[model samples]
Structures are given as structure tokens and as C-alpha cells.
Target: MMNVTRGRTPFLLVFLACTGLLAYAYYAQFQLGLEPCPLCILQRLGFMLMGLFALLGAIHGPKAWGRWVYGVPILLGAGWGMTTGARHVWLQNLPADQVPDCGPGMYFMLEYDFPLMDILREAFTGAGECAEVDWSFLGLSMPMWTLIWYVGLAVFILWALVVNSRGSRPLEQ
Candidate 1:
């Protein structure tokens, strides 16, 4: 239906906005010189995947099975973003004494032949660097802000998917 078709444009816009946010993150990293922790990098990766999937979904506007297929990556990326954001939030709230010691850089872990599982475990468990509060707004840190964004995006995608699916059903008189 026309309503479902209209939803596709908003999907592209929302994803473009997300892409802009990631651009700001990069600006903070390069221009402002805020080094991203491992968890931050992981969150960025999730956003990247979400942005890619959303862009494709917008361009293709695939129907039925195709939309469901697109939904898979979007959900996965949003889930990944939420998981990493939650971990970062937990680390930030920990007491100084409870914070884990800093580990080697991500490059070190990957380059040193560490097992993929070990790398993921260490990243998720976090370290001293991951707990730092380098940026904040309205008293919430970057991770907190990102968590909020991921939640909103996930909700929007779900709502749009449901609307589109319903459009395919025959209406009762």
C-alpha cells in the first residue's frame, strides 16, 4: 500500500542521520582527539553494519521475503550496538577499585594470534580504558547516549516492519 511505500523514505532518512552521528564520532576521534576504547570501536562497527543494511533496505525497498531478510541484519546490528553500549554503561558505573586493569590494544590482541573468542570475551568484559568518561551530555556519557540511539532505531525499525507486513494483509470490511 501507499503507506508502506511511504515508510521506505523515512527509513533512509533515519539511517542517514545515524551515519551522520557516526561521522561525528569520527570527528571526536580525529579532530577532538578522543581515542576510542575497544568497546567504542565495537559499537562503531555495529552502527556501520546497521547503516549499511538500512541503506540497502531503503534503496531496494524489497517486498515480503526480501524485507524480512533485510530485517535480520538490521536487528543483528542494533542488538550488537545495544549489547556493547550496555557493557560500556556498566563499566562506567563501576567503582574505581572495581574497574578492570587495562589490556593490550585491539590490534595487539588480533595481531598476536589470540583466539577470536578470547578477543571477544576480553572486549566485552572491558578494561580500565573502557570505563573512562571522556565525554558527556546532560550528565549521560557517550555510551549512554549511544544506547539511547540504538534503542530508538530498533523501535523505529520494528514499527516500520510491522506496518509494512500489515500492508500485505487483506483488510476486513
Candidate 2:
């Protein structure tokens, strides 16, 4: 059996990580002048959802089944982020001629009163802007990094779930 902390440290850590990621994203957008496409915006929302769920779970500190209630949304948010990240990566890898045409910006769509579903459909289909690799680290683009982060966070959540499932007792006195 695994020994787990009764306190909400693990969940708190996850929340903090998500917050840090979002903070960097804003920094990249504002300071670095990286314009986020619609898909990027969606990915940000995914991170926000994950962080929100993690914060709530940490605050509630529920055991057993309650963890599942929180875990599901966190996983869902990760999955959403992964999906968008994958799409963005795919777009980036597409040949120049094969890339999708650039579409209207999300703000423009909203201001022009485009239907909600149409906006989502266009966003998911991806635009030329999403394919541009304006930033990279260790040869991996931002979307690739985000994909990795989502996978890592999901795995961490799973491990925390298993460890914390053992008992209600704190791992340390």
C-alpha cells in the first residue's frame, strides 16, 4: 500500500504549475509579441480549466470517489489541450502548399456575429497562423511543448490519484 499525504500538497502543486504555465503564455503573448491564434486561445482555455479543477480539488481535499470527480475534469482539460496542441503541431508540419487558408481572427468572428459552432469549426480546422512556428525551444515548437505539458500533468494527476487512494492518513506525522 502507498503512503499518501492527507493534506492537498499534490493538487496544490498541479494548480501552481498550471498557473505558471498560463503566466508564461501571457508573457509570451504580451511581452514577446507572440500573437495567439484561435487554436492557441482554446489551448489556453484548456489550461485554465485544468488549473481551476486542480485548485478546487486542492481546496476541497476530498478522498476516494471525490478525487475521481476532480480527476475527470483535469483529464478532460488535458485531453482538450493535447488535442489542440496536436492539431497545431500537425498544421506546423504540413507542407507550405498544403496548409489551410488563414481564417478570420476569433475577435473578428465574434464581433461580426459568426455562429458559435462555425467559429469552433474554423478554429479546429486550423489556420495558416497556427502553422507558423514563431517560437521554439530545443527544436520543439510551443504547441509541442504544450502537448508535452498536458501529457505530463495528466500522468502526474493519475499518479497522485493512485498514491492518495491508499488511505486517509498523512504520509508524514
Leading candidate by TM-score = 2
Q: For candidate 1, what is the lDDT?
A: 0.83
| Candidate 1 error regions (>4 Å) | 1-7, 111-113, 168-173
Q: Report RMSD (Å) for each prediction in the order shown.
A: 3.2, 3.1
TM-score of each: 0.88, 0.90
**lDDT (Cα, tens digit) per residue for candidate 1, span 69-119:** 776788789899999999999999999999998888777887899998887
**Alpha-carbon error at 20 in model 2, in Å?**
0.5
**Considering summed lDDT, which 10 consecutive residues are worst modelled in model 1?**
1-10
Q: For residues 1-173, could you state the per-residue lDDT of candidate 2 as single tens digits?
A: 43333457667877998999999999999999998888888899899999999999999988787887888899999999999999999999999999988889888998999999999899987567888899999999999999999999999888778766775455465
Q: Which segments of model 2 are wrong by more than 4 Å? A: 1-6, 166-173
Q: Residue pairs in steric clash, candidate 1?
A: none
